[model samples]
Target: MYDLPSEFPEEPGLPDEFHDLQPQLLSRTLRLTAYSQENWFTGTDLNVYYDPTHVLWHKRPDWFLALNVPRLYNGDDLRMSYVVWQEQQPPHVIVEFLSPKTEREDLGRFYRAQDRVIDPRADQFPPPLAPVNTPPSKVEVYEQYLGVKHYIVYSRYTRRLRYFQLVSGRFQEQTLQAENPRIWLADLDIGLGIWQGNFEGVPSAWLRWCDRAGNWFLTDTEAAQQRAERLAERLRSLGIDPDDID
Candidate 1:
């Protein structure tokens, strides 16, 4: 069993606005008819401890979703960090928003077996253990250790979305058809894709969840605005001034 850290460090540097807004969008739009909110856990920028052996080793995903996990730990307490050994459930899907500094690691291109320098003092130790120099990349941790079902990487710089599915113990990149442009997540019964439009007053590409029929879910604000417009239209059809009624 792994022990939780007494205190996890705050994420370094000033927070980027996109990082904050993007995860919020994902969380808000995630709707599963099959499972209640209590049965699902969604996290953003939260530490996830995966390796029981290496207790302190963890990964902080930009956003992630775990099915069949209590939304609140013990049904009352909020989780400080997600410990895989204790939870006994892995994240069904993990998404990473790529930055220039983290692009290589997020894509699994930073892993180098040759770069691992084993400790030379292992032979003298009673429990003979060798320490590796370089930590495993984020992709390696998710694909090899955690066995996350789906791993997604979105590059705001390139405005491109990439998908990877774990198959036969490895991650295989899934293709996005140009016609559809959405990756279907069978487990969650939803699709994920990039939506080009203004979000939160910013004109940029944002990741969004869509239905099987290719209908993008609207955010709470968007839904409210839409409702208001429909009401105004109905009032106009009835030969009444909606603005005057308001």
Candidate 2:
């Protein structure tokens, strides 16, 4: 007698650890973009086609941002995936939330600043990736190929943030800050931060926290709602109807 084979579940696109908090990172990224005045786009499943030979296919960043792009291109979706050659724009900022497998690549230690740009003038701002006299590495070459400006890696294991800025065509490490902390996107004039809040009935770390509470903090939307609720309650207490405010 012939027997049918038992069905097995399809394998996940990423490993268990990467899948866990990836959604949280994407959600925060979208929320931060919405908080900004300019429009921003993000995707989790899209493939970034970097190499024209179709040999190199990089999956989505945990989050990425490009400023001054139109909401839509040619009446089609802004992008199916970011094609550097086709789109002619590199991501202004890219962030990777650390997973065990990809942490090393995200924070490439061998990347040095002197390797990225050509010395047309011979006297430019210091290269971004390395101090003077320091030779660049494979990571530096990879970044030069990608044309990335700011690359960030946040460690869930350590709960720390590391930042690299592309200055003079090479990336330079900068001290990550939290005191009056803000992620200043000069192109958009916006910032990103963590906000403890509820989402889908669960407390989560949201990306935008625009107000201070009594030793607590609230997001811009949350704070607005609180203000509205308080004003309504005050009107009720004074026997003045909120509906009267037209």
The C-alpha RMSD in Å for every predicted model, in order, reads 8.5, 13.2
Q: Tens digit of lDDT per residue, candidate 2, span 98-177?
A: 54435545567733342222324436433233335433332453377676777766554444556677787788877646
lDDT, candidates in the order shown: 0.80, 0.52
**TM match of model 1 to true structure:** 0.82
* Best by the TM-score measure: 1
Model 1, range 107-225, lDDT digits (tens) per residue? 88532453222435535524313346655778889998889999998777766678899999899988887554689989789989888878878988889999998789988898999
TM-score of each: 0.82, 0.60
For candidate 2, list the clashing residue pairs, or say none: 112-129, 113-129, 113-130, 128-170, 128-171, 128-172, 129-170, 129-171
Error of 2 at 34 (Å): 14
Regions more than 4 Å wrong, model 2: 1-39, 110-142, 178-182, 196-200, 204-224, 227-231, 237-246
Give candidate 1 misplaced runs (Cα > 4 Å).
1-14, 109-133, 178-180
